[model samples]
Target: MLDLYDRRIVASLNSKYIDSKLAIDTLALALKKHSPKPGLLLHSDQGSQFASQEFTAYCKENAIVQSMSRAGCPYDNAAMERFYNTFKNEYICRYYFKTDEELNLGTQDYVFVWYNYTRPHSYNGGIPPSRVRFR
Candidate 1:
């Protein structure tokens, strides 16, 4: 999942049942010394991962409001759609992966070193995601 504020990936779980573990891990990483205010919101699609019982508890514990897109409505989450489109077009579609490790490493590089630290986003005033302030 991408944090809309900085476009930083807080979690990328590839599993059969993305349970509360991913949510806990993501919240831990994203909220490191950056505890959000009471009304702070974390928006996502209405995926099972975001709606799991563990995820709900974690959000309650952190006092973060969970905002989900309406069912069957992708337009409500346009920014995230854009992010995934860019991810697929720029990275995934361009490569022929020979192994799972190669794909994982490539995705890590794209998200961390390139997307966050190097690539400048027009929406971010031509600054990299790492330089943008939280919303």
Candidate 2:
């Protein structure tokens, strides 16, 4: 999950399939890391993983208000689209991981170290997301 306020990646996971389980697990990780108050708004694409009954129930149980992009409108979730573009070009394309474990660790490091703490973001006036978030 990405925090729109600061552009921080609150949680993420990699899986072979985009299923409700993956959605729920990633959301659970975000919840554990940051205890947002009730009525938190979660914006996402209208994918089956995000629209499934289990995922909906999980959001409701966590007091999250879910919002989805309009059908076939990627612009509605432009931030996420941009994030994925950057993630792919800046990180994914630079390395080859031979194992899932390596990929997971590499992803964690990228989000926690490089992306959040070091990389400059145009949205935050060329500062890192962590700086903008924690300043």
Candidate 3:
């Protein structure tokens, strides 16, 4: 869900359970929203979902290039590492959720409105990710 260029999160999902189907669905939804071009690069860790045949076929059909992080190497996906750290430190740890619904809503608000639109990134010259796109 990380945008390599602007460091934006294109989409996210939360649920009681997750699998390849959920990953594929989120990817489809994200691409629909963004209208990705051919040769678009989608980088992710070597999770089972990302490695699944269904997800691989979808990416291939859509002309998206897939790059996976190396095993045991966090630096290969440093952007996601930084993002997860920020997310945990700033929002996830600060919230006290009593229900799944509440947690989902809070995550949605934090990712979409606060993280993408309001929070500034040092990599983006202190501008929000939504305002710092290269294209």
The numbered model that scores best in lDDT is: 2
- Give the Cα-based TM-score of candidate 2 against the true structure: 0.96
TM-score for every candidate vs. truth?
0.77, 0.96, 0.92
Residue 128 local lDDT, model 2: 86
* lDDT tens per residue, model 1, 16-50: 34667766676776677455568678888887878
Please provide, for model 3 over 1-135, each residue's C-alpha lDDT reduced to its tens digit, 9 standing for 90 to 100. 888889899988886656788888888989989998799998888989899999899999999999998898888899988999999999999989999999989999999999999999999999999998566
Best by TM-score: 2
Q: Write the per-residue lDDT of candidate 2 for residues 112-131, one digit (tens) a residue.
A: 88988999999899988888
Instruction: Give per-residue lDDT, candidate 3, residue 122.
Output: 97
Model 3, CA-based lDDT: 0.90
The true-versus-predicted C-alpha distance at residue 91 of model 2, in Å, is 1.1
lDDT of 1 at 46: 85
Candidate 1 lDDT score at position 77: 85
